[model samples]
Target chain A: MSGTINHGLAQLAAVDQGFFTDRSGGGCIQDNKLFCPGWVADNYDRYVHPTLQHLVLVGSAVAAGFLIAFALAIFAHRHRWLQTPFLAGTGILYTIPSISFFFLLLPITGRGALTAIIALTAFNLQIIFRNVTNGLRNVPANVTEAATGIGMTPSQVLWRVELPLALPEVIAGLRIATVSTVALATLAVFANGGGLGTEIVTGSNITFKTGIIVAGSIAVIMAILFDAVLLLIGKLLAPWKRKQALV
Target chain B: MIPLPALTLPTAAFGLFGDAFNFVFDGREAETGGVTVGGTSQVLDLAAKQLEVTLLALAVAILLAMPVGLWLGHRQKGEFLAVSAGNAGRAIPELALIALMAAAIGVGLVNLVVALAILGIPPILTNTYVGISQVDRASVEAARGMGMTETAIVRKVELPLAVPTIMGGVRTAAINIIATATIAPLAGILTLGDFIIARNVYGDAGVLAGAILVALMALALEGTLAGIQWAMTSKGLKLKRS
Candidate 1:
């Protein structure tokens, strides 16, 4: 029991001392290099691993959000009475500040990736759900009528006609969710879910400019990269939009 | 550090919600150095600070972005600028912007306000531009044919018509600013975030109470702004609504 307490205290001491001091035998400002490449080189595992973890956290949350929100959107669409309550609930969830959401989940999930992903997934629901419903609703009435007249079942019409027509808006929703999630996932560090935010938080705590710049730039770059890729996917998915643009 | 104990799912969930309720209703005098509570005055004080930061940032963003967006929209120019700026702003994470500002300006209220102002700008700017450009071009043309100057056409016809959309943008910006302002404590500004950031000192009760407070404040701001948005809409616009 005493040994366990000592281990906990040591960990606390290390956090207080700052990770840089504990790892590099000094502050981040050794030899006037704003960020010592040597230190980063030595600590490649720290940076690289966190970046990958950040990607996994964000990717899983977006995927989970898409599946859940899509299912909810379909259910709400079929039953008109459910739409209002469903949207209102997700809107309330989105309105809760990200920090509050994280702490609210902390006790139940503890400090880990699960907590971060769940919070992130909740945030994505409003955007994805709204867009999915809007897209399906925007499908022209005549198209659905024609599908039904051709002996298509309601389910068949949804799969063959409505979903295909709704693909543009759905993909647009995905782009928005993907970009915002990349940004919000940085908060995962506070929840003990390792991500680029870990570096930002540590840098801020220690006043390390190099650490802040490197991590901050990487996060921004990641957001832009994800956004661009999603935009490309959006264009590819909706080739008619490209043809319209050409005209 | 609290020792880990295995908890059933129901119990953990109950504890989470129940703890938050108790913190707001039954929390005792704080034994910490961060956010003090047990009295209305302390909670009110932090809420005021949070509002001040949010309002100041939002005001600055409006001052800077609104005129440019309005002019560009009136001229029907800079479509690329408006779209790209909105996209770029959305792409930059709020935390990164805050950290960058802290590094550049050093930690303080100023750093947080600057970062948050940048966050608030895009929505308002884009909305203003879209709102103005989307005004009935026929009305603008009619005003011009009636010998109204470009400025007069914009002021008398375009601006009033654009109010709903512009207000829509402001609503979005206001909510984003209010939500992001919770992070101000990290930049050495005392706000509701102090409750969560100093959880080790304030304990779970303080953290939960803080979360509840922030959530309530955000909801109140959103509700108030939505009311304003609705009130500002012209009756004609309301009648035209689906």
Candidate 2:
């Protein structure tokens, strides 16, 4: 136990003491040259674990947020009186800032992906909840009335009529939440939830431009990829909206 | 605002809430040495710096974004540009943006402000455009009919009507600016984030104190902006909404 603790201290010591500890081999690295493609190529494999961790962080948080917000939206839909309080609660969660949120959670949840996920998930609640509620509420009352006339129960009407109409907005909210979460998840390193941020914030200072560019590009790519996938899913679900767009 | 902070019971971060508050309001002993780290004045200075940068970056974003967003909105042009810009803007990682700006451009108040402003721009621009375009067409038409210029129509009719939405964007920008400013210490701006990031210097109490202060500052600024938004709304619009 002491060995592990000593090793952890040693690691932290090493991080603080050096700007570029492994810079001897490559001329590019030795000079601290910006955009060291050669060094990046050699060290590219280092990012694999952090990449996966980041993916899990962004993915699970968004998924959990959507579920909770969707349920809340449904409840608020049923009981109109619940809307204000729910909005205010989620708004407070959304307002706190992610770094502060992560550390604030440190004492309670302990560090790592769960704490990061909880914070990220809480942040997402407001965006998703607002969008989902608006989407549900925006359903033309006439359409629901027709569904009711067709012998549809309230739950059936909600699932078949209201949710389908709300698809575009819900998906739009997802895209925003997903993209922002991808960016925000980089800060998860502070909580010790590894992500692409491990590369950028490798030390007390970030003198290594190459590391940042590589990690940031991957993160941006991830955000775009997530966004595109969500967009395609929305398109598939709302085919009529697609057809309307084409005209 | 990018979805933001969360809170719960403070645990291993420090001894107790009282201790943390005391750490903020009175100098605290560091873990390694007998050195005193944080106190009321230090905390206040850091808070001021954070607020200054947040407002500065927000002002830069407003100045840069509002004209473009308002004009696009007034003309009903560049919907794709405005929308896609906001979407694309969301994708830029905050850490990456900060680290890269520091690495490439050199670190200082100017660079940090520029980096934070980059974040604030998108939401404000998109919202302003969205808000202005969303103003009732009839009102704008009536303004024009009453011998108003395009500028006057935009200022008098569209802006007043779109106040809530535009302010929503500004509010979003403010939240983002303040949040991002917490990491300004990474780029060498010693805001409240310095306490959080330099855990070695301040220890757990300092870190927790920093977190608490940052959270409170965010809430306070957000509340202030909410008030501004309310005050900016035309009384007619307020009553109509009520």
Candidate 3:
């Protein structure tokens, strides 16, 4: 695992050089192409690092969000009275604009991955919490009753029966949160968390079309990839859902 | 004791919050280009610009997306189109879209509006499609049986039934656009983002004030839409659900 991470980091270093370093020596014109291949060759690291950083921001945020949201959902499910307040609070949190959220955390976190992750985690809460509670609530009462009748504890029923039934909606929520986080993670660069947004911002500032396209495309591709992966996980976790082609 | 990151704790966060409060309430006069700029009035002006950008984008998005979404939903023919559009929308980050547009078109209000409008389309489109499609087939059939034309059935039956869901979509789009418009400054369009984006010029207080205003704007819009959604939901449907 360390070896893979090290290899990834090495590639990211290459991408970083591509992004921050000036390749003025490389001619802008080659075969009349607007984007110079020589420049790209010199700056490969620029793309790799930002892309990896973007994924790291998104992945960690989603994982943290899921844990928090899952706990909240379970708590709310057990104590129905908490449901309204929990949803309302998270709903309010959800509406806090992404960029503003980042800035709000900036003072506390001081511009880094921590602030970005915290803000991104907060953004994911409403989606994940709503979906999780909905999923748990949707688990048929009869199944739980049967489990209880068979001498299973409440925890056992929750784990074995309810959770399995709830997997589809839970995974659906995960998919949305993951995709949205991947998209939003681009803003992490504004917090100095470093992501593909840096490339786009720098590219736009300098009017570098190749940098903008490469970085923006990677961010979009990352979003799509995460969505696809979550969708696949959902399918695998709940094979029964495969019969019904609902998104 | 374990080492903790700065500002992670509530005490530290609240301290920063206090600084933000002081900045907004008591900070020195902010000047840009040798002219005083920061104050309540400036924030309000920026708020108006933010609203203008958000409203214009939403209007265009609704115009572009609603008809196609409604038509496809009514026919139940373009599920692929609706799904693909929604996915594509979700897959593109707003910042990247804004940056790409800024790069391609150069910075201006029109460019910002176009980027934001694209961001606003998918939610409205998907929600409209889902809403109309989810309307009871029996109700649609009854309208048809009563000698209602296809258009008439859609207008009188399907649309009314689908109002809440469509409104929900609109609400989502509106809020998304509002949040996204905060980044319009990067495109050289002046909005609330100007304060946050130019933190050095505006200071931490200005950034905090901008953040607060943006949050308030988003919350107000969300609450207003939620209220509208509640009001527009048919009484019969509410009763049925309860």
The two-chain DockQ for each candidate, comma-separated, is 0.42, 0.43, 0.51
**lDDT tens per residue, model 3, A141-221:** 888999999999999998898988888888888888888888888887777778888887763263565666767778778
Residue B230 in model 1: lDDT: 83
Model 2 regions more than 4 Å off: A1-25, A243-247, B1-14
What's the distance in Å from true for residue A20, model 2? 11
Sorted into a CAPRI-style docking class, model 2 comes out as: acceptable
Give the interface-residue alpha carbon RMSD of model 2. 6.7
Residue-wise C-alpha lDDT for candidate 1, range B86-134, written one tens digit per residue:
7677667777677667655778887788889998898888888888988
Clashing pairs for predicted structure model 1, backbone only: none
Could you tell which candidate, 2 or 3, scores higher by DockQ?
3
Highest lDDT model number? 2
Tens-digit lDDT string for candidate 2 (A75-116): 999999999999999998899989998877666666677888
Q: Is the docking of candidate 1 incorrect, acceptable, medium or high quality?
A: acceptable
The lDDT values for all models are 0.78, 0.87, 0.81
Tens digit per residue, CA lDDT, model 2, B188-216? 89999988888888876677788888989
